[model samples]
Target: MLKVQEIRELIKLVDQSNLDEFVYEFDDCKIKMKKHKTETVAVSVPQISTQAVDLAPQATAVEAAAVKQEVEEVKEAPAPEVKESSTTENLHKITSPMVGTFYEASSPDAEPYVKVGSKVSTDSIVCIVEAMKLFNEIEAEVKGEIVEILVKNGQLVEYGQPLFLVKPE
Candidate 1:
């Protein structure tokens, strides 16, 4: 039987890679993960676990959160010929410090704190994340331009999930 933590690690690997499907058999249990181009990671445990039968569904929920990030990256560069060389290496990702609902503005009618092409300093408030009825302001720890918004307004975000990609100054 595989531990729950081990299963989560596998899910992360498959999400980061381009593989469409991943299968692993441990003991009498078989865990499979399938990725659809337009959807989140799907996990299926066809075989029963000798240790715990109830753990299957929990693993599915974990994999479901793999990403809304699969929504194609929004690139700022219009130059189609720009090579991949050292482009992403210089970028900094502003990730969610906690799991919550991501909001672009304090109020729904207010303007967003930042947007693509907007410049930011380390102390700049970029967005707000609401968790357990508390609203937390997220900052741009790195000085840079907002190159991409990874999650949509009102979207649910997980801890350590990339919220924005910044081209550092």
Candidate 2:
């Protein structure tokens, strides 16, 4: 049986990610979590054995009620639409090579490798992306002047996600 804390942490991770659903199965246990609308999470545990597991007893009644209430409240709320900025239409994008945490500088105290209006060549290191405790130097493959930084420092970035907008030299 999965612990309540573990389930909560998994829900939090799914909430922060771009995934719509998460599923885990082991032996006779299967747990599925789905994101409904915005800011709402719905958990579903299917019966895998003759003796079904009781997850309610694992968590306090109050905590379970609160989570249910929050889910209901979010369900009643409307989802927001996302639109791209018109200013970035003509700019060339520098995308992330892998999914990881983005960092503007080598270290917290160091200056950013590149900024808006900074000139860059194909070989220039623009930022670092840390994945599995390893920091990788991301290069600006296109020679250009950086016009915009799309991602903030220390933000979670996905593979092929646009990190910067450059004006080709």
Candidate 3:
């Protein structure tokens, strides 16, 4: 029987890679993973006759009912306010290309690639984002001077997350 952690790791690997489908077979156990356009990965595990692997505890009827009630309560709640930054109206934002850990420098001991008030061109590297052990250099993409750094070193950033704000030259 495969551990839950192992299954999660496999899903992560498939998500980071370009493969559309992945399959693993062992003795009497078979695991298959498929990626879909909705950003959902489906995992299929055949039933093993040897022993029951309890991946998750089955929810009780009472607990399921409670969850449904909570969902209804949340639907009645008001939406939260979103604040827009007026200062960035005329600024260009350097956004992350992928989900990964942001690095201000190539290495911990090295100076940061760019900082506030630093002049940059379209080809200038503003930072590095480490995804699946691969360090990818992120470009400024616009000719400008960096006015603010939105993300800190070693922070986890998501795709399209603003890393820096720049005033275009």
Candidate 4:
């Protein structure tokens, strides 16, 4: 069982992240939270046949308001497709596979793997995404010339977010 403050903290963390849903279970308490497309959070703290949360009975007005405030602070989700395709027609986007920090180079002193006007093949390494202390190399899946770098180094990137634009060969 989690205290109200702890639950509030968890809610804020989930809201700030790129995750669409989060679930937690400890002992007999089960909490599931999902972010909706309408800028609202749908939370479920289920009580199964025998698995009931003890915190439900203790949820006071103050706690509820605090949790609601935390949820309300979440950033809005990006527009579905209106802002992406309008200007990027005929260009291939190299997107991040996982949420992490984007790095243009292997090391701070090293040169970037790809830059604008740089030619690349199907397997060329475009950047690195550092997640959970592991560095994962992102590849240019399309053979092309780099036309734009969408994100800056050290910026946090969401899953499926575009990192580079390529003009196909």
Comparing 2 with 4 on TM-score, the higher-scoring candidate is 4
lDDT of 1: 0.68
Give me the candidate number with maximum lDDT. 4
| Backbone clashes under 3 angstroms, per model | 0, 0, 0, 0
TM-score of each: 0.52, 0.57, 0.55, 0.58
Residue 67 alpha-carbon offset, candidate 4, angstroms: 16
- Misplaced by over 4 Å in model 1 are 1-86
Model 1, position 49: C-alpha lDDT score: 17
lDDT of 1 by residue, 1-169 (tens): 4554345445555655677777776555676676655443753222211112233444564543432122112112121122234766788989989767799999999999999999999999999999767899999999999998888899767678888889999
lDDT of 3: 0.68
Candidate that beats the other on lDDT, 2 or 4, i.e. the better one:
4
Pairs that collide, model 3 = none
Model 3, range 33-61, lDDT digits (tens) per residue? Answer: 66543333653322211122222245455
Superposed by TM-score, candidate 2 places the C-alpha of residue 57 at a distance from the truth, in angstroms, of 16
Candidate ranking under lDDT, highest first, comes to 4, 2, 3, 1
Most accurate candidate by TM-score: 4
Per-residue lDDT tens digits for candidate 4, residues 1-169, read: 4654455446545755677778788665567777654433753322111111333555676765655554443233232231366668989989888767799999999999998999999999999999767899999999999988988899767678888999999
Q: Is candidate 1 or candidate 2 better by lDDT?
A: 2
Candidate 4 residue-wise lDDT at 116: 97
User: Please, what is the whole-model Cα lDDT of each candidate in the order they appear?
Assistant: 0.68, 0.70, 0.68, 0.71
Output the worst ten-in-a-row residue range by lDDT, candidate 1.
71-80
